[model samples]
Target: MEEGKICRTNPESSDQVKAVHMLLVSYPLQGHITPFIKLAYLIAGRGIMATLVITEFAHARMIASEPDLGNERNKVRYITVPDGLSEDERNDDVKLSQSISEVMPGHLREVIEKVNMEGNQVTCVIADPMFGWAFEIAETMKLKLAIFWTSAPGVLALILSIPKLIEDGIIDTKGSSKLDGKIQLSPDLPPLTSADFLWNYSGNQTPAEIMFQYFFGIHQNLKRSGWLLCNWFHELNPLVGNLVPNMFPVGPLLASGKPAANLWPEDLTCLSWLNKQPAGSVIYVAFGSITVLSQHQMDELALGLELVGRPFLWVKRSDLIKGGSSKYPDGYEERVANRGKIVQWAPQEQVLAHPSIACFLTHCGWNSTMDGLSMGVPFLCWPYFADQFYNRSCICNGYKVGLALSPDEYGIVTRHEIRRKLDSLVADDGIKVNALKLKDMAHRSISEGGFSARYLDNFIQQMKE
Candidate 1:
């Protein structure tokens, strides 16, 4: 943010380059795109040029037709490569992963060639681990390659220790643990049950298997990478950050003046509604962009919120329910009309920062977790899939600033259970204090001369030299 300048330097000669120009690449998912865009802004803030790369389909979906980061200078450029499929074929996670591994590199290579021919050489590429295949293209072009892991460093530590986890028979080749019990991936990290592992929940083994292989590839490439950055902060996860090499913890990665890269149009009306509510009285609910609930589960949640009878803003995404319309329980809206505001989407970071927000009811997606931490908002974790469960563990168990809502045997958070957790969270003064303390730590990590700023500055300096 150095005066919000957009610096693009052309090479005076091969012997003396002026600035670092990075190609920031991310997977098509909203989780991936959010942090990648923030990282782009972070790099560009240092007056280093950045071009954000994604699939043409993602480019159109998440990225609006407007210029990248605004008109005129457009400091960051947006480029797209075909994902080698029709819009219809891109939704299947397994197939999409395969397509990216096998098909995306060639398309990305062409884009790189085009950029080089235009005179701006791509000095570095910062990519999500999901785009591990890009390593080959970087090697082919002899470009500097870095992996931008858009998740907690604890997860990164575990993923890097897969070889040991396998050798010790803690986890099988397919990634399911050999024996189900409390397990510690390493002495320094928190103890984890099989629930923390992303693969166990997927009854289908293909995605799990693919993930295992991806972790393996990432670990293999870790040491050889030009640099590996995590969307995390050292003060937040001191132990894990200290243990991992090239693990520059420079995050809670956010860009000021830029709205979150929302795929769904945000219903900003909620902010006005929040303005009218009492300070620290509203419960903010959002389960990130994905994580659709079943009809039964949705009904339960609707009942639960009504039962809580508190001022709340719920981001019931248009796709909140699978196969069912985003409808409330019968007369649900009227029942809680005075206390609840339901929007398809809202400005999340803005909502969290608002004085009216008390605690968050979230699925514990990493980005949302970071947002909550950044705002000092305590949480009620209701994880649905993937790393969310692990993220929930980090928030509620590791950080001790949140509470977990356990679903019953049928995997539904009962209305009674929801009410109980909501009451418990609102009543917990200790958790609120812990949350604010964590928030101070988070802010300290990003402030001048702090760990995040130092790492970011070091990264830019490394890329420049």
Candidate 2:
């Protein structure tokens, strides 16, 4: 059997490659699950059989959002395991950290056993690293286990280094959440201030202690997984690649061409709006599904767009602001009438690919940044939290593809600052050209004959063998 190539069951033909059966599990968060599903689609498209497992709550959203997925009936089946929480117990605002760790693994094991009983041999278990218990399950079943870290390799390196730093007594429980002093990382790594290296250790534990415990658990499982899949590409992080050759960079796994809508309430009318704009003239802004903006911040953003005077499309989810619709600025929509377009949810890939998209005003979420880079759009980076700060640093510092904006003490991005940064990021023709060049490079990396495509083939080949 040829490696990583898709094959069919034809008795008459002798060119069949062994099909790898994969069980993919994602954490319950929307941001994490979405990317894994896209990767599963890529794998399934290559003739590998992939079963995607999600929590019951997440499964409902998937089915409700994209019915075409056809749970358990499609080429990629969807299985929903019990969340070990009552209907009332599942609240959107509360912490789900414990349920995923303590409850999910048992339900997941039962599902694995059931599938095995039904003659579906699970060749490998691919799970999110946050679901740490999966490592134990895979070991028990003697299946090859691969863990996916939905964060970047650079972030992972920082995560893995915490234990060593703790042992050296450089960081401990008594300090501030962010490091007080600047420290040099490894010689090869790009110098990041201590603040830049800090993760959001915001739960009950002290900052240093939190990082200590988190990294300790992660390192133990890191050794168990046969492979690690990261949502990064070589062009973005060649330095990290040199450090960890075994780590697979199979992404920016966004829609190559226009992808079909994964969730509903997609407003296709925005495409028509794009047609009227000149080439590379519109700013595409979306803060992703989870991040919420205060009503005041939303108003400031609106005014900021109005101040910039660029044609723009902003995705405004109805549930975004904490309060109700009353929070929206009075006469804000009417004020930006002809120049701006606002929709609830959008077909993001199509928007990014459009010739009219000049820049992306983003929250610096990894997926959005990758998508923007895939299409060659420069960014106005407003990093919210968790690895997003690191992602912003990568683009603005490492890639020269963006301009960063600092929010106020209250975390509000004022209109004046927005206007200034937008002008600077969009006006530089050389930066624009560089961004386009990077975009083309990113596209090529994911194409059929590219490095990322080959890596996908290699991983599958290893599994089948």
lDDT of each: 0.79, 0.73
Cα RMSDs of all predictions?
4.3, 5.1
For model 1, name the residue pairs that clash: none
Question: Model 1: runs farther than 4 Å from truth?
Answer: 1-18, 65-69, 72-74, 186-188, 202-210
Q: How many residue pairs clash in each candidate?
A: 0, 0
lDDT of 1: 0.79
Residue 240 accuracy (lDDT) in model 1: 77
| Candidate of highest TM-score | 1
Query: Roughly what TM-score does model 1 have, to 2 decimal places?
Result: 0.92
Say which candidate scores most in lDDT. 1
Clashing pairs in 2: none
| lDDT of candidate 1 over 1-465, digit per residue (tens) | 111112233223343333467888788888888898888777766777778777767666554622243433435667767677766677678788778777677767877787777677888888776666777788778888888888775678777778888998988887877767787654545677876776666643456666677677767767568688888888877777555666687888876557455677777799899999999999998998778888888888889888888998988876788876866777888889989998877778889999999999999989999999999999999987777878887888778889999889988899999899999999999999999998899889989999999999998888877
